[model samples]
Target: MSYGILSKLKLAWTELDNDQKEQLGPYLTFTDYREIWAMGIFLLGATALLPLLIVTIIHYQLIQTSVNSEFILRTERLTSNTRRVVTFFLDERLDALRFTVNEIPYNDLTASDRLSEILSNLKLGFGGLTDLSVIDHKGTQLAYAGPFKLKGKDYSRQPWFIANQKKDSYVSPIFKGYRNVPHIIIAVKSVRSDGTWFILRATLEIKKLMQTLSSYKTGRYADLFLIDRSGVLQTPSEFYGDIYQKLPLETPKYSSRTQAVMTTDAQERHIIMGYAFISAKTTDTPFVLIVVKQKDGMMGVWRRMQANIKWFVGFCILTVIIVITIACTNIVNRLYHADKAKAETMALMEQSCQLAAIGQLSAGVAHEINNPLALISQTAGYIKDLFVIKEQYRNDEELIENIDSIMEAVDRCGRITSQLLGFSRKFDIKTQNVNLKETIFDVLVFHQKEAQYRNLNLSVDVPEDIPDIETDQGKLQQILMNLVNNAFQAIDDGCSLDIHATREGSDFVNIVISDNGCGMPEENLDKIFEPFFTTKARGEGTGLGLPITYGLVKKLNGSISVKSKENEGTTFIVTLPVRIQKEKDGNENSIGG
Candidate 1:
């Protein structure tokens, strides 16, 4: 039954022309098992990576936010300290001027000698008084002392002279006055007992003010300077431009207390700046005190920490990928083996059912055909007997030949039916000594036509001295025939099939059937013997040939194994016991018996 189906499939595969083979090439190729493994690994890695990536990004953002907050707080503290020191210095100088004006009378301050003495006293005491001048209510200089030889110089048209006329005392912003140097003025308007008004003016040394401002300990990257309401730099900044240079930053609105803000300078450097407007009751002019620090310098420690965090995250990701790859590979490998075993077990069960059904069907088919076949044989024989009695007709060659042909055809039909019945019959532990050479030759005869049609070369190599084996002849024949037929199906024209048999030790015979044909991939090699698992296209096979052959070999107490490679061909080896052992009354029966 298996032979008939296998023969048909062999014929179909061998009959394919070159063009058909080309068209079917892709379909004939093995499935890409790597694609499955790759997909499994990718899914596993992505599952592990997505959450880690999101968490890492969130952590980085939180760290940056915290660092920025701390940076702003530190900058504000520095700016506040600088503003306090500068305000105190200006207020101290203003107090000195007011004290001198009230102590000396207007008559005494207007005398040149007396005024010079007072100037000397102020210069010694305060150390920043550059020059001194006395002016009356008419805006005329009444007395002058120190530097720039203008004892009678008039301050009537000057802004400071007019400003001091209205206010009792005033402190001017830093400016280049008649002396052509950056200096501030401290002026006091005084009234005598008779209600006569006089003004005392002094030019405050700018260098001393710069020293006082710089006395505050800002960090290395920070700069402290003074800017007037016009946004001009009043003091020389070590980092910013010189005195009187226009500051690049916008002047903030006047605030009694220090105000800190983040900004960028002209060079595009990030900076934190704080400003405060210095105001006093005696002074109408206000000056802005500014402290600036580069943001990068201030946040240097945080930047280092951020870099280290990045490296840590990178190492963690790398480690995770490697771990995921190893873990997923092991898991998928186990699953593949388990699934393959399950599939083979299922296929084996299905094959048993199919074989049982075929056995039943074969019996019914042989019974139904045998009756008509017998009637045809009997009728042909009766006609030959009648012709023999009629001598003249018997001598007629055509008549005799026709009857003989009918009998021969009927005999052929009977042989076919007998073989079918033999295949369907269940044997009960029957064993016989079978010649290895003769058995292989008989199986070859069935495939001779197929081999010739496909232009295949077939050969057998059995040593003449090899001993016969005790096995079921029918089962042995079926096993060899299935393997040869499978080889025929695997190959195209011009391929070869070689069958060889040899003795193994004293107990076993090894039969090898090898073909130079289109081989299978390693992944499917284990499944080739499984039932309903043919690599052939749909409708071309019933997938029962190898499984039935496997069962028959096992019934004879033999094992079969196959080796194959893509485009290289395949070989199947069957190992059977040289002497079959029979059981009788629960004891092993001797071979001689």
Candidate 2:
């Protein structure tokens, strides 16, 4: 690829500037980056928090609706349940009244004292009952209970008496008696089971109805009462303290729907109401079963939910602050390092150009020296040959040794020239799929003599499954040779060379060269990959080895990481891909170890 295109591709794929990488140690891991990204999205979207918070709210409403429905249903059932129990109790009391009157037979119970005994028996039979009375069809009150003399009072004009004239049996809605004790009268109009009209009536105090409706505790705000078809209160209400008094009804027409929900205008309260249409199975009068549940009583659940939302919002704010602080810190640190690295890199590039010029000069000197050295070696060889022919002089050991010394100097000069040529030339990288393990082995073979001279135990452990990696074979060999030479140079005679090859995940092969050599401190580690940055003394070392290795690794689209502890050991991990995967089929492919 052209330099311009390559630069663009690098910029697209890389997250930070080259300068930053040299400055900051390294970016955070992939996992940490992902977490920060998710938190950012959440914080950004927090503006519409409440509408999307439906998951926390809908359940409460659903449960409240279910309970309200159930309470209304249960209350209706209670109405029927209460009526059945009360009816039976009233029936027994009425039967006793029948017995008392029937036993008198129009002659034996003419006395007022005897009549009072009958009334007392009726009162004792029923609880919470006040006065009792018997009313004839002529509307005359015949016999009665309590201190009021109700014997000759006519009630034919009353609705209860008028309603009985058309029906065989009936119960009146609540009304005021002559003495004004709140009461209702249940009358049995006997007609010989053939629809004839002879009626009997008994009055019950309104307090009894209150006692029945009061059985429910409908929260603190709820109140229960019975309303007649005329919108008159049949039982005493907590709000009004009235019986048989008209309430301001929302509707004038009687309804049979049996249930309703409405807001009372007088109190401005939302109420859930349940009503039952009266059946002949209970009473002749069309009474209603009414149950009330106040909406104000349900504020507890709402208040608690409000408190929970407060805590949730607070937690979100705290989380956002933490994430933003972390993000800003990381970004600032990266920028600082990048700027530092850029400055250092510009300086280093200048140094490299100067060094390259010096290398060119050295190569020219080596070439000039090599030609003279070759001539000297040839002359020395000819002298040795001449001496071999002169037997007498050949026996002179001093002359033979001197000639050998001259040849040895020529040989040493030739080796030095070769080393200079190798270091100075710029060879084009020949890329191919080279087995990394095999390349390492080649380097080891070339350095076998030096390793032996140092009496070093060299070991190799390459993974059997390692893939053949794409790289310049010669460049890799040179890099490995430099590293191995450095390793040998670092160690004493008894120390060993440890080499291992393994796959690093799916996309890379890792070759680790570790040694228990005299390691450097952290101060030197930072400059270890810089050109000419050496830890060795003036005559012993050139600092180009690691920098060359680093450059070669980068050229192969790979990386090198090092870890070391002073006096303990040092490891150089070289990572390379198994194949040079081109971007194809609209996807990036990574192939490796």
Candidate 3:
């Protein structure tokens, strides 16, 4: 019987389709499932955070470079624009002086009125012009404007006079004026009507050029300033305080002459210098229009790039987090349910083995008790018949009392005989569609005599509307009979047993047998599924009852599980399929033998 239960348990376990099988597969143990979930969660979390971290770093670097680049470029442009405006102003002033030098006929001028009129017009045409002078071929100041009262001071020894002798126009390097004005001299050569060369020298103020460059600001990190060819500050500098302050003429010691942007500091403050020469506009003169912009001033561009990068990083992080969370949650949920099903299946398997062993033992006891019981009943009837014929014996109180004891013995024997026949018979089960509630009631009727014999209370708890299930009648009867008997044996006096039936899932009906009996310990529960395992005393049980019941349940394509608490009670739950196939898949093991 124990072997039968084990076999049936193995069969029922095997009969499960893919979904049920997966829920109880050996590999899907709780610990293994937990580990899988843990790994999934870890990977998911990493997926979310890693990309964000990477993007944030890259964004920072790119913004830093881009902002720095933009600042330097704009600063260089500002410097160039400043130089051009200054050059144009100087060129125009020189041209005006040249016109005066060429038109003021030294031969026709009887007085200084002609030169004065022309000088005033030239001064009015240019905003920052300080002085305009006309020098002859001999370097003599032919005419002068403003406070310079000289009419013929230079006689031809000045360097600018010498250069003007051969050039159409020229710009002198920045120089300080005798009158303490910061200026550059613009010279132009003119051919007088006498066929002799003359020079026009004009002094242009540097402040006006500085104001042109300072007018525009590039973001917060960009401030533009100019450096002259000699590396002197040509435009008003925030660091040096004035346009006249000279910077170190040589490039920084660490700087390489690559046209790339660089970081530097003016007066201890960091700046991004975009230095480029005005070679395109300046005609091969050792004059560079250097543009320098501060690094910190370009923060607006940097900040914008940084902001974009931050948003990108944030988006990536959010996306990863969502994806990982969903994946991990799904995996964990599946594993959790799978492990739960496996646990229930394992428990059912154990209980089934325990019942089968008890059934086998009980069947043997029932057989042994049957013949003696029949003889006792026949002998008691004969004694009663003799007593009836002998009126005197019937009237005797002692004899009547002995006869009553015999009759009582006969009645007990008959009941034991009936129990033996029922327990020993290997029923031929007839399968049909039967309501699970009706089946529970029928099983209770079969157990009524046994319940009366043991003085045990039995109760049935089944819902009225339980769906009909296809199962063998005899087999289900045998299963229930074995279970009730075992429940009676497990408990002492004053214990009650409850049998319940109900619809479970869509395709299964559930029956639960519960008893407030002496339950086994946890350790014994583990071994209860093994063949011949029993907690019953010697001569009381064979431990085959549950096993046989287990076998019958399996044959009907059902499952069973037992939950027991020591000193409390035990519950045996059975889940039977509604309609079992006649020919199950070959992979399913046989419940029989």
Candidate 4:
């Protein structure tokens, strides 16, 4: 059903250039008219919004790029600043150790009193120092102060001791050493004139270093921590892992300057990371300083901005579509009305021209046809004269009646043709004594030959009690003639026509003419008497017969109505006044075109 409607609409939308379907926008029905409105809105909406969407997307991408770049740069800058602070913390402690080792005599540095004094001063000055120790050339701890009992401890096989043999100084990563507490060592070597060396080692607790890192500002879900080259956390983390535990993340490759990248954690949360491998100038130890932020948290502002932009764009699109729809509807409505007005004007012009041609044609045809009618009327009159002069034929009542009927028919024909010539002329109402049965019989006389030719059954049911009506005999005759003529045309061979005359009341009478013909559908019954409306094929009818009949009935102050069903039959009922009911100034009445 939908496709069928669409196909018809499509056909209505397109037509040949030579076709006369111009300016008739597919508004055959109200539904088609609304559908056209929808089509216009859809097309115009696409036209208006396509470019808007393209531009919004392009700008969204650009703004996203700018926001992401800003986040990364801010992360790198924070990491770089924090790394400097950490580097300075380690350098200050290491420098204090270096100064103490170079200035003190080896024997004095190894003395318990001297080392004990040094540990006290170091603790008072730097505050994170846990101990001071002296290791001899053989990797034995010769002296120690301020921490656990290690006065004679051996450290020859330790990694830190082994590393000291290769480098001038070292800053060890946080570890649980002999004391079994988290600490970092800053070691310095002192050489004697004999080229044998001993080391001055200072141990710093991890608490102060962890405190330093915690002071930096970060995001809501952010973490700042240090990791070694092997991906081991040196400082405690808020999220990743505790100190000395392996990080559940891929270790970043080393870079001297601070850099940042995005990755996911073991728990599958996205993270933004900034890292710098800080190589303290005074120590060989390097640690990666990383600042990690939740990817969702880091882009909070940008995401909010994106959402706002989307909502704004959506509102704009809706507003534009609404505006376009209203505009298109207004434009289409105006066009439709203008075209309707133009079409009506064109139809009126065409109808006026047709009426003019009909007026001229009727004049010419009436003159030609009236000549034969005049000859027949004259010949019938001369025959009546012969019948009157001869007693043998005059006394024959049937012969007299036949001759009179012939003259009456011929005179009726003459008046009809004359009326066609002046189509707008008012008919004269010649009121006289009208016998209803005799008038109906006289009208049916014209159809007898046709009824006999088609073998049609004709019937009339009129009681003799019907009173004579005082009406225009000529119009009464014509009215009955047209009704009976239509009935004859409607009925097929061997079909039937039924005519009945009955008094409607004391003042009105009804004449009913019915035929068993190919009846009119119910939809067309109302419009059957309208001018230029007919169901007959082209050239078979002029479509003016019933219109004239209806007007003539109205002019006589009567009413006409029809009832029919498809393939059944049609019945026309005419109600006429029983007594003479003249119009105001009846002699001056006219039927307007």
TM-score of each: 0.70, 0.43, 0.59, 0.63
Q: Which structure is stronger by lDDT: 1 or 4? A: 4
Over 4 Å off, model 3: 1-26, 29-83, 106-118, 124-168, 189-200, 205-226, 238-240, 248-287, 290-309, 335-481, 484-488, 491-517, 537-543, 558-592
Model 4: worst 10 consecutive residues (lDDT sum): 11-20
Alpha-carbon RMSD, candidate 3: 12.0
Cα lDDT for residue 176, candidate 2? 70
Any runs in candidate 1 off by more than 4 Å, and if so which? 1-43, 165-168, 191-196, 217-220, 280-285, 344-361, 427-551, 561-573, 576-593
Highest lDDT scorer: 4
Q: State the C-alpha lDDT per candidate.
A: 0.76, 0.64, 0.64, 0.79
For model 2, the run of ten residues with the poorest summed lDDT: 584-593
Superposing every Cα of model 4 onto the true structure, what RMSD results?
11.2
Q: Candidate 3 vs candidate 4: which has greater lDDT? A: 4
Task: Give one digit per residue, the lDDT tens place, for model 4 in 386-457.
Answer: 998998897888988999999988877777676565454445776788988888888888889988898999
Better of 1 and 2 by TM-score: 1
What lDDT score goes with residue 294 in model 1? 83
| lDDT tens digits, residue span 1-593, model 2 | 46643443232114655654554323322324335444554564464445545654676567667766665666556555555544554555556545655555433333456656766766676765555555655777666565676777888898878887776566766667676666677776554334423444667776665776687545565566777776777776676447667765453345544545545535777655555545444344545555555655755775686678768866866776555545544554454446546656665555455545545765787889988888899999998999888887878889989999889867766765665555466554456889877888988998788788888889999888998887778877877887788788778887888999999888888889998888779778878976557778753445656765665565566778888888877888888777654432121111100
Task: Give residue 384's lDDT in candidate 2 (0 to 100).
Answer: 92
Tens digits of per-residue lDDT, candidate 1, 30-117, equal 2333565567668877887778879888988998777766766776676677666666666676677678788777778878889899
Task: Encode model 3's per-residue lDDT on 555-591: one tens digit a residue.
Answer: 6778878889999988888898888766643312233
